[model samples]
Target chain A: GAGVSQSPSNKVTEKGKDVELRCDPISGHTALYWYRQRLGQGLEFLIYFQGNSAPDKSGLPSDRFSAERTGESVSTLTIQRTQQEDSAVYLCASSFGTGGTYEQYFGPGTRLTVT
Target chain B: SQQGEEDPQALSIQEGENATMNCSYKTSINNLQWYRQNSGRGLVHLILIRSNEREKHSGRLRVTLDTSKKSSSLLITASRAADTASYFCATRSISGGSNYKLTFGKGTLLTVNP
Candidate 1:
């Protein structure tokens, strides 16, 4: 639609399984970011992609967490061998530019539950 | 690693009253932003104050940044029940590039009673 869109608003999976969350950013937006928020906790930055540049993956919690963005459009976050601690809401945001002044538009987020 | 820390993990205030939340961060920053989230949904950007700016106003929302103190405050005047939500401060480190990721605080949960 007009705003950022995320798939699988809610997902439940067994521990040790894998999960992939998707995000479709606003049309033409050049910057996309991924974050994770645990229950009663603030957001933790995961990764960021700007245009065709190599993504900044400094924030990924572990090697198990990986993400990719293609053509500055759709992005996916993959969590391998999920653990109970991975249960949280995964949020995606996009902005018009890589500048510090731009405001980010956020998606509804995907709530992942690892049982 | 987290960059900001908000004081008063939770707050309760009466409607029509004012509510204030404070955030402190480590290391130098290029800019700081505030966001609000309701019921674990998407976050809405409220206001942003650059390191060079001391204060900014938007409607009933006021934000202040003290670079020397490495802290910021968000004030909501004439609070309403609908204003009750979690407020978070996100900071962009000066060392990182302008497009660097934003590090967020634990957040302050505000409850406005009618």
Candidate 2:
């Protein structure tokens, strides 16, 4: 009965370094999503994965951002050559992939700070 | 490129008073959801209102949707100090497909003073 879980609750890295954030969705959840939240701003969609289909990459800010989900359980969002502007809280969410379920459980998130 | 917009960026009210937050979106949506975040950490799903349904109630929380106006409102009755947090409205486009991605608004910061 665990909710979504994200590792490395906080990360601080210098600009130009790469960082990987991990998320573990609840059991049986077939849909996973990543989002970024800047200070005092709204949640920005990043990517999504459903079952075995291709992930939705339209929301990735740039090529530096990428994500991969192994099967339907774990996902990792990677930032390559991070920039100072990349600082924000990275949030992960998952939901049941049934026809009309929209309630998503969220992880605590990884607060990434680029200096 | 945000689809939903919430009014009154911030609000302050005394405990036991009623609080209302409004949201407006630009596109047709399959459903609208409300979430609460404390200390900028994880978001807690509060309620979800489908496009067909106009109103819903969960405990002291009341949510109403008007597809004609592309708007929604969340009202909390007899609010407590514990209710202070950042509230956001997320919209799932009618054409969102299987991605299940939600477009969120800027959010409203509510401060309940006890």
Candidate 3:
């Protein structure tokens, strides 16, 4: 892909339902990240994957939030028993590598509305 | 907790004017980056300033970093209506061990009138 791509641009789910968000990173990119942003709020770091190793998982808000990546390719974020507070935009980004200076390219994001 | 916070939550300006936004962060950082978002969509990278560098420019965009004060500012010269969007600043922590994550600020919403 020429750019980072996210699936199901918009999602409306009921409370307690499970939702899965997907991300397809740019070709040959080695680093992937997931973030959450509430309305009128800054982005919240969720998880980061570099190649096949993730050294940081401290940002995941709760046990209900979990994510996984396969190789250096696609990644998925799963939210179990979603709550009304879960209504927000989920963004995914990828960089050439996990280095500190690499700039991340973001996806269109998935707007999840929990009713 | 947000590592960075942008000032002036919202600003409205006419086209051709300059738009400036500031970001302040706690703790040291290896670099700072600015991004823009339109209509709640994904963010687009604008510019980045490393800790060793004081200022950088790209096209109509100017970015300045003050590591000593732990603050940064982004200046968009001759702004256009197309520049109407939200601007955010993100910082890379200076802990120095695979710190690839970027912590973002609340962002400033800029509206440029025609």
Ranking by DockQ: 3, 1, 2
Q: Model 3, stretches more than 4 Å misplaced? A: none
What DockQ values do the models have? 0.77, 0.69, 0.89
DockQ of 3: 0.89
Q: Measured by C-alpha RMSD in angstroms, how accurate is candidate 1?
A: 1.2
lDDT of 1 by residue, B17-90 (tens): 99999999998988999999999879999999999999999999999999999999999999999999999999
Sorted on TM-score, best first, the list reads 3, 2, 1
In candidate 1, what are the lDDT values of residues A67-108, reduced to their tens digit? 999988999999999999999999999999877788889999
Could you give candidate 3's per-residue lDDT for residues B1-114 as a string of tens digits?
898999999999999999999999998888899999998889999998999999999999999999889999999999999999999999998887746879999999999999
lDDT of 3 by residue, A59-96 (tens): 89899999999999899999999999999999999999
- Which 10-residue window in model 1 chain A sums to the lowest lDDT? A96-105
What is the lDDT for B67 in model 2? 99
Instruction: Look at candidate 2 and tell me the lDDT of residue A43.
Output: 96
TM-score of each: 0.97, 0.97, 0.97
Q: Would you list the clashing residue pairs of candidate 1?
A: none
Candidate 3 local lDDT, residue A17:
97
Docking class of 3: high
Winner on lDDT between 2 and 3 is 2
